[model samples]
Target chain A: MNRLTALVIAFALLLFAPARALDIQLTSGDWQPINIFVELFLGEENLNGQIPSDIIADDLTVSGNFRAYKENQNHANAMSAERLGDIRNRGGEYLITGTVNNKSGKQYTLSFTLYDTLTNDKIGSYSIVFNNENQRLVAHNVSNWIYETILSKAGIFHTKVAYVVRHEDGTNELKVADYDGHNRLVMLTSQDHIISPTWTANGNSLLYVSFEQNKPVIYQQSLLTGERSIVANFKGSNSAPAASPDNRTIAAALTEHGGLQQIYLLSGNRKARLRESKGIDTEPVFSPDSKHLAFISDESGSPQIYQFNLDDNKTRRLTFGSRYNVSPDYSAQGDVLTLVRRDENGDNISILDIRNGDTIPLTNTASTNSPSFAPNGDVISFIDDRNKKNLATVSVNGKVIVFWRDSEQGEIINPSWSPIKSDWF
Target chain B: MKKQNFASLATIFFALVLTGCAASKGAYSGNIEDDRSGEAGLAPVSAGTAGKASSPGFVKSSTIDDERTSTDSLLQKRIIYFDYDKSAVRDEALPILHTHAEFLNNKGGAIGIVLGGHADNRGSNEYNLALGQRRANAVRDIFLSYGASANDIEAISFGEEQPRAQGDNESAWQENRRVEIRYTDE
Candidate 1:
């Protein structure tokens, strides 16, 4: 009789398994970043021993939740038992070790493993192949996989940040780089300025505003093929381009020949303008759910952040404290919007909670704008002019902030992080 | 003695009022001119080559002629100042508007000007662009009222992107919040 009942329950579960799969939630929970330690790899010939380990350490540190420490010795492979004792003695909960082999030409292979020293077991092991040019990226992939295995969360190691850099010649160039600001590639350079770049959902294309045609025109550039086409070139001015989370719609701020700047939604050739007062409406960033748009409007008086609802065609004010709250960007969870708030001193970064309408100050440093969330929503990348206009990232919940700069490259501004797709990992 | 003193004081006050020598013209409103030394100057009540320090030769060529120096001096004033967060045309901007309007009307359709409006870096870039455009439109409206055809001028706003002065102080902000009357490069 016990066996018969167990068989019946198993059959019911098998029948309802599709429903369970359908109801699986894609959301992750609020958790704190953990500290992890990475041991140096054994092989130094492929690209030198420390390059891959340093890249992994940098990626982990930038993730906001992890503080990675390097052991100085490459002894995790041969003496696993002794190394485990050493890591435990050093107060490390987890240890990462890897080996590299140089193959023909630019081809190389990495065999990295993450160990749970507390449990005395291997948590993750990856065998990845990359050319010499992408060896560092392969190490980042190893870091991300370890993060996924440990935290049950998607890692941002493979993500890239797109931003605009102003050259000394007064020209602007769009470039993409590793999340840690390593291995940058310039996409387009123009005689005029480019501002407000947004990555599409698929991460294959980017929407940006360029003044190359002597006007603020929005263009969609394919990152793979380098083909460019104007998405929004109105009669007067077009700028502040952003893509919806669903990737089915595009939103941007546009002005006609003699009109006020207003937010408009586009789906192919069909377009509809959202209702806004005579206020100067611009910089419409779509919420992750695509239900509301957060934009900067000066309708009530000075420029303040306001949200527009697509369902009801109504706009509500989000910020009331600062008179100058602009350049807003919504977080990945759609619960917070980071924007620039101006006080008597200078512009500072501030975060606004959508639930209670309460705001918290992010940075006391002046001369910062365009605060964008990291793909994981655990970090934010903003343009920091505190030290000559470099790309800066800050942990969302922590005080750990890092700045990436190339002095030869002029002022860097307006950084946009790619979104994390369900299948990204 | 008290009555005599009262009568004498009234006489002195009335004489001073009638003679128009009580207060200087620029004591209160002239502080902004000092803040705008390197910028294009506004037309002044008195003509002593007031705005020549910054006005380009293109603006001074026709206005510096000897015959119409009075009106030409007004035309030399090319910068229009706006109140903070307010794009409406103010009374102080009227004289400069009249100067540019007269310049446009008298120059026929031969001269075209682009009214590029700008704002300080206190607001969002695109909203500032619209506010700057509102200012440009305000100038354009006043110019149209003064007999300049619509085609003679185009209104554009660079917003806060191209600031005339780069600083965090009030003086720099005052100089940056303006609408410049630029002659078309053509």
Candidate 2:
């Protein structure tokens, strides 16, 4: 009787399941994730002593679009009809097979072929080479290829994140780490306070404020050469550096004239003050096209997000109904903004659709700060300080939330996700 | 007056320890005598005297050590605490600011001072930075009103980075929301 009931349930599930993988709607939550079987790349373990298939699978799964599993039974690099049939029976809608070819010293090429298991058709084959010491970049690149081929959207697995770690000894270290919070490199260390670390559009350098001279001074440091240059060292506080998408301008807040903070755009040696207000204007973030800058200004008697149009210099408010809303970060598509909205319940991260004035709460935590959008515009990374300070990332739809504890001492603050860059180093 | 000076001096000493001021470290003792050299040009104002001297109660006497110690006592009250989200100077902290203003007005261009403002971990970092900048500017306004040179003063905000207390309670928040006045040479 139990076997009969199980068979009936299985039949019912088969009848209800979507007929084709392409028919599955990516927007709905009720649909099953597209199953992918990743086979270890040939010569991958021999070249770098690392498996790219595992990383690829993890990236696909973390993307919330696909469910990936490893296939160890098939050691063949090339897909066969019988093997494809076996994978199709195991619920794999897609299969990924790859090989590694060593080009030269420290240079290796990763070749990948994506397959549609249901149709038994080869989608395409792509290859990416990496000479950097980080072998993980190859896998991330492969995942990006698969993601873009399938979803028609860019992948953020290869991007980096910049954050500040405050040590117990009163020193702060500005660090850049991979998106997974590994392979960290300390960019700057100062005995005094350091805050507001931002990245250049090209991801070549960083702009941040350091109190090493007993006052906040904005400095731009190159990640490639480790050279540092002062961007803004005005009389009063100079902070909240946001690089323009064009890579030619940086918007920062300076308390120059009367100690009232105002936004300014600094490009090359010419500085242009954007706004003049009696109240505070800060936390400037440029849109993807650099056409407008969304910033925090308290000119409305309460802190709120405002957008400054570069073409006409007209200002419009983006957030309302809340007394306190600051720290605005624009999405890659420039359609939505991720920011912190504070109310009676405490601070929560919310995303605002720019087309309409609708707001969606991405974090329900009482105290979350510094919400920055991933390059893909599907996720946001922020600092959750409800208890101890930690890092968290949430999908834009508020469906997936992941928390990462600070494995080292001290609290992690000011998490800024880097834009999508081609090079890992 | 001597007794009052001793009591406030001890209190300031404890405050220095609590605020983690560098002067409270072991280098404090020997540096006290050296620090006096920089202020040697400063002449003590006689009681109820006129000319630039604003605070009558802060009249300096010929007893050099007592006079210097009293000045140190007043200077050691470096931190000015603020209420939550409020940058305006409180009534209780006005007297301390007045003392600092008189000193800055008296010192003239001999020294440079930096007012490091800070905030608690409650709000966004950059907004708190602007808030902190407001508090520091508030303190700087008092000094400027007393005829202190704008060139000799630099007001900056550290936001929520440097907190005097690490707890997530009201007491810690109050302690963390403050403006710290320090001489540039320190």
Q: Which stretches of candidate 1 lie over 4 Å from their true place?
A: A1-33, A45-50, A79-82, A343-346, A421-425, B1-77, B83-90, B102-113, B122-124, B144-154, B166-171, B182-185
Q: TM-score of every model?
A: 0.76, 0.79
Screening candidate 1 with a backbone cut-off below 3 angstroms (N, C-alpha, C), the clashing residue pairs are A33-A65
Scored by lDDT, model 1 comes in at: 0.68
Compared with the true structure, what per-residue lDDT tens digits does model 1 show for residues A1-425? Answer: 53344335434544553211011111133534454667667773435222787677667766666756665566546747667766655556778887777777768777877878777788778778877756756787787787788877888877888887777777667877666665555666665667778898788778987655334567786565444556875544677888988888898877654667788888898878877568778888888888999998777778888888889978889888667888888887899988888877778888889889988777777677778887778778887565655778777764567776634558886788877642322
Model 2 residue A311 CA deviation in Å: 1.1
Highest TM-score model number: 2
Clashes of each: 1, 0
Error of 1 at B4 (Å): 78
lDDT by candidate, in order shown: 0.68, 0.74
lDDT of 2: 0.74
How displaced is residue A271 in candidate 2, in Å?
Answer: 2.0
Indicate the residue-level lDDT of B95 in model 2.
77
